[model samples]
Target: MESTNNIIEIKIDSYDDLVNHIKGKTDKCGDLRDNFIFRGLSNFEHELVPSALRKDNLNQPIVNDYVGGDLGLLVLISNEDVKSNFLEDRVHIDLGYGKWVSFDKNQHPFFDNNREYLKNKNYLQIKRETYALLKFLNIADKNGLKINTSYETRSKIHNYLNPDKITFWPKKSFFEIISLAQHYNLPTCALDWTYDYHVALYFAVKDILENKNNDGVIWALNYRLFEDNYNESNEYKLRFYRPEYHSNPNLRAQKGLFTFLINPVDEILDCPLDQVICREIKNIGKKNKKTVFDNGKDLILIPPEITENDIIFYKFVISKNAKLDILEELYKEGYSEDTLFPGYGRVIQNMGNRVMLENIKNESDKKPKKNILLKIKNCEDIFQRKINYLFGKFNFNSEIENIYIYSPESQEIKGYFKANEIIKNSPNLIWEKYHNKSNWLKKDFNNYFKDNKAYAIRINGLIEFNFPFKINNLSMGNQFMYIEPDNTDINFLLNFK
Candidate 1:
């Protein structure tokens, strides 16, 4: 079978949870099911099957549902709440397995028959995983999902369940192939985010295989020429796809997703993925904190922005404090030499950076597709400079917003091309429908920065400009460059002229 169709099919993004809801599931239960949706296979009809943990051959003519039919659907549900401190209630409510009901690992296949599994874990996480997996299995049981229940299917399922995200922590274990081979009938898979060491190593390799190819995985390891890209200690990682010991094109390609994870705030940020070895899959609650091997590792620290620092400048470090001089902040956390990020000035200094306000002149100055370069005398007049930077992430983000909204002057924000009936019609820069507090600031230039005294206004009484500012906390008064009345800097209006 073609690899595309020959997949160990699973579901994740598209299964509606309404069916489970109707079954009188939890009120907060998810309406969408998450699963391993694989679509690629080589054989289907008659394939060799392995005897499961039972050590006996599976029944011949494996149940149609049992034979990985059209696709493989393994739905897993987690009973653990993800947050419960089982350290106190460390005893497992013995149902079948030995009397050890603990969750050092996250993706333990949950069974409806087992209620003791519901221990300390995120209510939402376990809910999403558990119901999603089970639902897939139920569907497969009834109609025979496509996939084989053999050795290869097991390997793939294992890859999908544990995933690469968990290797940062090794203690975050999952069921062994033997145990998994025991209970599950149809292709089954699960997801866990527990903090563990040994498990992280296995998952790291598995993650490499499933997600990337060859060049990809190796690249995940921060290669060191002179310990410039990474620290010497960080270089202690082992490359799983090295040609001498490891030579698998498929395995190497999957490693590309690996990143050099560094957490400076926490003592434990060494949750290595591929090159760096990490076993730091902490409890589900720790969202983005760095996982260190012990609580003693020094984390990269940056000084918080002291608004009163007399020097109204900024530095560009890892975004710890809300403020810094500019984006040029850099300090070495590890032994590496090359600055991880080259600060903000380098970004703003680019000539073709194309701020939104300048885009109109840019497009107008250029023909259709030939090296588009537009020049403007003033950055303020053509359009508000701040808006351009705010929405620059999208080549079409401005267009989408314009089609949906209007502008400050009630200009009915649209492409200037359509209104002018010009030859090469370009969309207008201002969006009228964008009737939020942001546009309101543009409506009144004087009072815009009146409320917040910390503004850095410029441009003769017309527009505002702000770059690299996260929109959430910023207001016209606190952090913006505006043009107020009575001031006439031709730079603002003359840019368009």
Candidate 2:
């Protein structure tokens, strides 16, 4: 563990160690309920910066070239009732003192030509435009009221042009819309944090998987510390905003909140929250003429009267090797992508992640091989005729390692087995166990003989009866179909238990 004033950094070897450390801070009687909020990074070296504020040289130009480019335009485009023509016309913005600027549909305050103006003014211009569009479309509106006309929309936009006009709407309403936009991948000044440590750990493991060579980090901030020291009169203050979660399932599941670094004088500062906090602490130390230590990076100033035990920030670096273990543990605790992000798209993404993890585990254990789908016709007469041909006479593909059996009659994939498992077992043993037994067994074997060359594979004691799903895009007459490794269906099948 390395300590720097009020910031402590701990290197964690495994998931258990991470949990134990968090429990030590949270489980004590003196600890306030939900004292800490966490944010996870894929790389331990990453700084605590919001997505919109990150200074990416290559992408910054693209983000600034258009309004809401960094934030995403999906929220704007998805509303069918909201016409784009409302914002297509050129409009003049008053910069005060008779200085005026014109911005068309493609131009924004963030453009290079507008760089001479104050950044806070530019930031407000973007926000006003975004809020106006949202209000015009009635997207996630608390009252669900629409602006009805382009004139009304323009009026709302013009109203927010002035700095003092921000107070026109209730504070909660303003933050709610911005938070909603942020949730949908729009770039915002706020950083996302979760009250649940497990969610943070899950995201950390997820990041480590994507960047396999890099170690992950989870930053835990003492919520009580921020709450205790927060002053409304401070020139620079950190504000915590928890939007109502009823409208956003993802936020509710993740127990998410946002931390905003507010500079009343400037309104915008392109620095991480930790650095801002450290700077404020350092200034306080200097005012009192107390001894202060600064590392220039990850600095936190502690007064002489304060003890090290009152540390407010912690960073835990987790080893990349523990990624899989942590993910499995999180899944068991119901902290998975499907739960955290409730949507059809996230469900598919979760399955893809499961498939990738399975492939990784399989590759680590043995040589990887291809998986194939074997479709069969479900009929008793067809099975009796092809029983002799499919058991041993018919040659199976050597490259095919796993065979998934599909039934046409039921339109469902019944189960699967390893190609070698079925081939190594004698034909007599398979026939004895499955032949003339249950009706379902007969249908499964019958499908193998429909096309005379054993289109379907027979399932015996060697086969695993898991992974049953409906066969998609296959015609009723198409009894024998071979699926390649790259087929999209493989992702769903591989996710089976």
Candidate 3:
């Protein structure tokens, strides 16, 4: 364990070590896995669990001591320590003239049909684009859109856009436009965050299960503490801005919040560049020590603050052995891909993770069948699409297999039907817990399936069932399925051919 710049690093060999360490800090009793409130750094003794090793009883002064001080923990549960700065959004943009870069608040970015321009060098073009963007924002604000115009400079922009000269204005708000741009993957400085820590953990470890040789991490930060620091002298150490969230389903499903970086030119100016770009920049810097780009063109940098030593930042490194337990715990807590990401795209990615993790859980099965039950527990709309596609491709028939559909939401059997029964009377098999009778055979039947409303599928399918919608849509929501059979009574069916 070491401390630098007020940030403490506790290097644990395993997850138990971390849990035990956290346990040793508090005076509470019970398992280390029990949920405990991670409050501010002022008297964690009463709140910390695993009462036996409370602060008074501990034999050593270690990293845990900071938990009760002015320090707050921003845990990143990764196999490796993260090097990216706190404000880095990890997005790059195509800034024409063969120059692509991430957002730099110190400069304006604009482009024309013939070429692109950066604000630091191309004042005329940047000014024109800024005026256009501000005009749009003003129009949006006048139409009741929530644009943050509290800045005194906005009054000048409003005057510049003077209503008398305006012929037409778009109705969408500034937030909506930025959100849409972000949704489509345009280079924007909006870094994504979530209110749920479990969701953060899910992302951190989602890919860890596949590559066991590598470790993963979850980063926890005390933004409030960070704000206090950034606001201390008002000298502008770092500019952090959170956007107003709207009705974007993906953002809502992920519990996402956006934080934009403004004027990070100085904070990140001397920070190391990305490895791929580092070599190129080093070559250019060696030739001209003062300016890397031609004509004094420079890029804005951000995010070193998150990894640096700070009371507001902390991270937890997750080892390979501890990854599964943490992932399973999160799954039980309902932090799977579907819960964090609502669409079919995320559902499928979550399904892949589920399969990998499921295989890890069932590695010791005594009697593994050639065809394991592709069962999905706590099914959602996306999972339903997956099952439909699987049944269609495999020709799953009710007569040969026992198709059990149950509503964990209502704890009732939606129906148990034979494969042929679905073909004969498809409406009878409708799970009213989600979709109603009107949607049983409709084209959009799958669209109505409620998310996170637990449903279960426990049988194999043949390649003859005609399911609506392409199989690709199945990959969107919470996808958890297993191959080894559970206690559910059913003759799993699959076409041998």
Number of the top TM-score candidate? 2
Evaluate residue 103 in candidate 2 and report its C-alpha lDDT on the 0 to 100 scale.
34
Name the better of 2 and 3 by lDDT. Answer: 2
Better of 1 and 2 by lDDT: 2
Pitting candidate 1 against candidate 3, the one with the higher TM-score is 3
TM-scores across all candidates? 0.19, 0.54, 0.36
TM-score of 2: 0.54
Q: Candidate 1 versus the native: TM-score?
A: 0.19
Candidate 3 lDDT (Cα, 0 to 1) = 0.36
Total clashing pairs for each candidate: 97, 4, 39
lDDT of 3 by residue, 35-125 (tens): 2212111111122121111223444212132122211111111222112222222223322332233222222221112322233322221
The parts of candidate 2 lying over 4 Å away from their true place are: 25-33, 59-98, 101-173, 208-212, 229-236, 265-267, 287-309, 366-497
**Model 1 steric clash total:** 97
Error of 3 at 458 (Å): 35
**Overall local distance difference test of candidate 2:** 0.55
Candidates, ranked, TM-score:
2, 3, 1
